[model samples]
Target: MSTKKNNPSALNEKAGISPPEIISSNAIQQIKESRKKQPSSQELIDGILAGNITALSRAITLIESTNSNHLTKANEVINGCLPHANQSIRIGITGVPGVGKSTFIEAFGKYLTSLGKKVAVLAVDPSSTISHGSILGDKTRMEELVKDKNAFIRPSASGETLGGVARKTRETITLCEAYGFDVILIETVGVGQSETAVHSMVDFFLLLKIAGAGDELQGIKRGIMEMADAIVINKADGDYIKKAQLTKVEFNRALHLFPPKKSGWIPTTATCSALTQEGIDGVWQTILDYLELVHSNHYFVEKRKEQNQFWMIETIDEQLKTHFYNQPNIIQLLESTKKAVQNNEISPFAAAQTLLDSYFKK
Candidate 1:
């Protein structure tokens, strides 16, 4: 006999992990019994309103999850939390990998905290999932800021479909707002900077650059420059200092070639050493001044409203694409259609029609 008086096995033992067949009533009951119930939406709302970071993180994860089952609960949480949101400024920042985006954010975030404001830093790091298999490294770069009490730092998960940003980053921003974060900083994967995905979502868009040859400017696309509300030349100390200033003048001239941004605010150029924390305050002041100008003109409110509408449509488009490819028959038909097109058995137009017809019929 076992020495334990209350042997778990003695009391109607069950397997630790259910087998496929056990996924019926027995497993259902076990799931019902063992499941850790999520906090009620009201409780989540209260927790967010009270500035509970754990609750804020959980809420964001719920919004980010692609599980169909959690969407209803996520929406409930959003609905309950909505009234408490929209209180913070959402800013988008992007730069190439070595341009000191993390350093800049850390310094800027600390400075904001000193001003009695809470800041949240979220980074999109899709590049991490390249063949190199590196981890998302933005949070690591901001080690000190990550540990700060007034800051919330989340690294965008690798290989996320939506530009490495969780599909719910926009929603997460609202959740952070409910938790009393006065500023929400969204950092994008520093790719070619044709990141309209990030640009479409934020009130203020900042592009970070390093002083370099004309080739560096060519590396970043012109489309992104048009979207930038400000451009900061990072690494503005040391040997790069003079070059950074020259780059600023170059950008200022370039900015003039395009019309003012949709909000009618002229983009400003500045230089800073994010590593040394020089001119960081000036960057923040530029952001604040831009906000003040836009807010007075009512463009701030309208911009967010338009972003919400854009997200709504974008979500629908994504879901439709997912649905199109996920249907079993549609996958088969799509492959066949591809081969047909490649072999010229069918015109591209006809092949597409056949695939769409099959998918819709299914």
Candidate 2:
């Protein structure tokens, strides 16, 4: 006590033990303050245009936020970034579950970055309807791309959206494009109407398939195939090579049965081994060729215009539905109306009319 140790390390030395490093309270306070600080919308837009990954990530989080205040900020950010978007090539990739979508995207994104192209991978993960939560594990699965500075990977929950894509994915794409990403890859939540939703948003749609899965058609709907600009057979290596080739031929034949796409381009089928990085170039080349073909025919611009119009109408419908359901009277009546219909106390059409009338009156 007479010779007081001024430092914890000195006291540890007296006790013949090593001292654990400690952070000061002031340092912790600084960190808390930094985290609590929210950037202005203009700051976010400037950071995004400057290619700041942190700002881009924060902007996306804002877009995904459910809070009304955050949504207002997110809309402001979107408006700021919109002028800089629509410059990148947007590609939608979809397949049945277990079709190696994560693997293929990792390989494809890595290849694109090697060519000096900035790539962004947006993954839509299936969410539990009961919990409304998703695993959000695509970034973990795509380990290599996660380490690459040129590649940005984001995994979003599908929420209640029917198409296996997040409600905010289109806006996210705009933000990615604004960040100067040359290529945008949207991975849908396996197979379903998600393919159609993705097809509506992307410049090119790629359907991934695998062989030796018994069904061969692989549970992929015929409608999804019709939407594809290219069908790629994954796992085309080692013993599966022959099976992949046969699958390619089968897909080509099947694609011929559908009417031609409005793009005036024929859909092609190819094989690739994402594990081996084999034939990845061919797939990219096929996309390039399609781009050239569509641009030459002016289909690319026209398709984008059509997509914009489609989304506008879609937004209106969604808003109207949300407005109708969020009304207090509708929420109170919804369960009772369903019960009445089930009990045959009221006709289904009459129940619907009553609900609509209540909503309009409110």
Candidate 3:
């Protein structure tokens, strides 16, 4: 055997083969460092309060997670953020399909950022039946706002939640506020009962409408109109401008017919063109004026208190229902009980009582 050390490059050159490239030691060290342990909950909290967008996004993801392992961490994060939250203005925006909600939100969010306001948009997209995942197309629709450094847009899946909002939306809002966003816009999945859920959480609820849609009032629920603090007619550019103007007048009249709001602020109507970004500021001004009016009368504080209580009760109800349905014994009994009720062997009320008794006894 030869005593000389083997030279891989010399051998490759003799064989007419190229030598393999090598990764630098620095790059190897960076890759190892990148795989370091994830930040603790306190680290996440500190980052969030320090206005770190990545931290904030991670915190919101935790809140939206259904993983049992994440529940405690998520709650701790929310608790840590609670003291820093609720300082921002929360606005709920809803509309019927084709009302251009994403377009308007982009325009409105851009306007707020232009005024040096840090804006956060929480858009709730309808979940797909097959995958049960959000399309998350709002960010694509809001091309301009997506590029704004001062703006944060999070699109969440409705995910079997009845109210056209993600189940964790309220918690997500808290995280955004803690991250120092001054203006938070929650975009619902169009107008319906989901609007009521959004109305309960937001300070000001805005409904977007369009013109020349035959009967504008036909599709919208009466309760939804009452929930609105303002109704905006979008797509007001060019040929639609006149139609939008007319619709605005009609909406103003319709608003007057509803009973006065407890906030003592009259809901107003305006038209805007999200395409041209016109009249966007007017809608924002209306919101600011309403905020001033409510804050002055102290209704703003009271309303938040009411919302807190409402969520508390709602949470209790949900938990109780979840607990009852999730019990092993209850799960075993449900099918048989349903059959009993179906076959007229037991009354529906009696069957329900049996299930409740089983749950309580356990």
Candidate 4:
């Protein structure tokens, strides 16, 4: 009886290696239970005010959800959080592809957290028009920063908005501020209208460039440079120091050509290596100097008020568009109108008028 009881359940050790559970079953059950108990808006608000990151993330999810009920709850949360926002500095960082944006943000974010500050990173990644999916590796690439307790890295909220920031980004920012983050970093990885949108909302705009051909004259991104509070050349350590200096001088010259900023602060250029963490602290110092000047004047308050008004108008426009597109009558008419225009049977403008008339019962 003793020998029989000692026998293994598999009966043979050489059959195969039994895979152990990588995650505990109890944890999975707990996750399911928590999902079933979806927190109320007021609970979410309280949790955010208390600096709970999990609650903050869930609140943002509600803001991004397309469901009508979710949107209503999201609006309530925003209104509640609004009173606590505008307490943190909003910074937008932009760079063209291959400029090491993710790596730079990681290094910069880590540096900020080391100063006993809470940092939040929101990346604007426009979804592929064809696939409706965004490249989400940006959050994962920030290995050290993501592990930092005071640093929060959020991947892009996927959708098409007017440009710059996503439609729900402002609400997300309010929630983050209420969660007690000192610095809000908006990373604009997408090209085009995104830059303008971000520039309108952020107190500081930074453009990151790599040391490359100076023949283009930095005029290629002239519009972005004009909006930049500062320009920093990255990858400046490994055999690129001299080239980086040259690029910085070129950017400084280009900056002088633009009209003065409303804040009356001249944009500065510098170089840093994200890998070596060189000059990262100086970048923060430059931002502090800007903050000091802007705060001493009326520009900072005026700019934020303007941004609120701008977003209010934008929200109205987005709602009108969404309402128009969601109507059954308009949806059916749009398909036929598109085919008519493509077949050259109707002028595009005339087709648009037809759709509008149908939408308004004209």
Candidate 5:
């Protein structure tokens, strides 16, 4: 009895399964040590283009790094991958906390997978620390769907951005496409204004809401609603079922008050329960309808081009600001200028002009 208990194969036999070799702890350590050389950025890119998940993860890691050394290679990888990008559908989802954003995505992702479509999810945690890295709570939140072989979930470290979107999310989108993920879902921090940043990159923007006592719209900013391509009132089952319908009508009216979408696509209102999976199909159908309308008018292609241009400029602006703030002399100048303004030694506009002049001169 003692010998059987000590034998590893005994456990498998008791469970009616075949026995397998169990690597020793020393062997495991050696394997990990051997992996230290890690693949190069180009190898990762090749793997991504070949649709390797491991390579995709490593490529994203390179893009997320602030290390100066990785930046050049990262750009090269992106340049090589650009020709293969833009073939995927990019969707952005946002809502207040507890609005069931993750649940909705899981259900919708499963639905998409069932239709033989490949889905890649990049869930922006928005609270991750650069020092500690992302904890990836979304993967655990989406337990069922995460197990599906066809799905890929990447939880981004939010860094200092308002949206949970990581600094490299735009590049991550391109990498996902190279990996053959035809449907890419980007989920942002539920905080409303940050939704705008996510909206700027996506082809379709979805806003989720919970049925409430007429105060739902109050918590959501008008700007967010205005940017939304569709409004989904989630948790639309059981106790909230009736209220969901009423909220849908209210949203339809509210959506009309805002200007029409840039694609001339009408905003749709729907109710869904990520728990019971109710109305999930309708939400997807609504998205397809909007996509169909936009594509027919050639807004799809034109809008994507505009988005690419916007991102290029946005990245440049952000890098310039970061460089400006990080300069030791500029930091000292900024502090001195602040004190001068408080003491009434300089007008705010004059200080700003001086700062700009100095900034450019440097």
Candidate 6:
């Protein structure tokens, strides 16, 4: 009867089985705006310690900010949360892109929550070095975990540092720990330089790998292999189950070639399917066993202490580099020096020395 012959919307009713809203968006936005209207450090700390997710997210956002203005506030929040942190077991997970890290974390996180444990996931998404852009779609990928009240999934901060781990990630862990999360899972992007950084941060290092995809003997990386506390061959269902098992055997053999771990815990290797939820519980058991061994041998507390010291020196190196590069003269000279070095005008080390000279002169 109308100008339009038919309306597609009239063909179907609303989905009655849609998931329920945990909290209204309007309510959350209103709360955020109110708190953002000049929240004191202690107020944010109070909210975080009281187990308020919004408050926890806001504090983490502040910590990840690069603005100089937020530095003091961020430091205050970290100092406040420090006393309540180090109470949780931090696990770092890394793998190549398309390794199903997101799916695995979601499945693993849900399993932990089912056991009455609070889980916080800091997931990394693919980032571009040229554009400094990230999709940040991990929250969407982890559909079930996002809906679970006992779980918190945060897409790790992107841009600037593309080494898988996020900026100020350790600070974020402290904040999550203070918020009463029992398990903190840090998911890094790749299996390269980032692994070293992530390895030093967590008590347990889990490497997620898939089967029959450029995963041959050549893929055996001794450096990453040595860092791993557990190698989980994911996507182990369907036709690939046998291949996964073979991969597991290969990894187990490769792990044996490495020296013994200081924690007195041998790296565990197993296969699991995130889709079918198979072997998910075994991963948790492996972690518990490692915890028992490390705790009993006194490596738990000592490892954390060593990590703290490492970060202190690392922060100094980072700040010095940032300060050096921020100088007006260094900014002006860097471009010219880059062109000269690219043209074979100066040795790489000499170019570096030149920049250092200019920075010190400034």
Q: What do the candidate models score in CA lDDT, each in turn?
A: 0.82, 0.91, 0.88, 0.86, 0.85, 0.88
Give the top-scoring candidate (TM-score): 2
Worst 10 residues of 2 by lDDT: 7-16
- Model 1 lDDT per residue over 27-125, tens place: 788789855777877778888888787788778878877787888888898888888888898889988777888889999999999999899998876
TM-score of 1: 0.84
For candidate 1, the per-residue lDDT at 228 reads: 88
lDDT by residue (tens digit), candidate 6, 122-191: 8766567677778899999999999999999999645555375634887899999999999999998774
Candidate 2, 1-362: lDDT as tens digits: 48886655643446556678798999999999999999999999999999899999999999877675687899899999999999999999998899999999999999999999999999998988789888999999999999999999999888776565635898899999999999999999975578878888999999999999886756556788788999999999999999999988888888888998889999999999999999999999999999999999999999999998988787788768977988889999999999999999999999999999999988
For model 4, the stretches where C-alpha displacement exceeds 4 angstroms are 1-31
Clash pairs, model 1 backbone = none
Q: In angstroms, how far off is 254's CA in candidate 4?
A: 1.1
Q: Candidate 5: where are CA atoms >4 Å away?
A: 1-33, 128-135, 216-220, 331-356
Worst 10 residues of 3 by lDDT: 10-19
lDDT score for candidate 5 against the true structure: 0.85
TM-scores, all candidates, are 0.84, 0.92, 0.88, 0.90, 0.85, 0.88
Error of 2 at 340 (Å): 2.7
lDDT by residue for model 4 over 1-362, one digit each (tens)?
Answer: 45566556766665667767688889999999978998999999999999888899999888888897788899889999989988999999888878988889999999999899999999766688898888877777888998999999888645777453756877788889999999999988548678888887789999998886447483456678788999999999978999999888888888888999999999999999999999999999999999999989978999999999998988899888888999999998899999999999999999998988888893
Candidate 1 segments exceeding 4 Å error = 1-37, 127-134, 158-162, 192-194, 213-220
Off by over 4 Å in 2: 1-19, 217-220
Query: 264 in model 3: Cα distance from truth in Å?
Result: 0.7
* Winner of 3 and 5 under lDDT: 3
For model 5, state the Cα shift of residue 153 in Å. 0.5
Please give the range of 10 consecutive residues that has the lowest summed lDDT in model 6. 157-166
Local error of candidate 3 at 317, Å?
Answer: 1.7
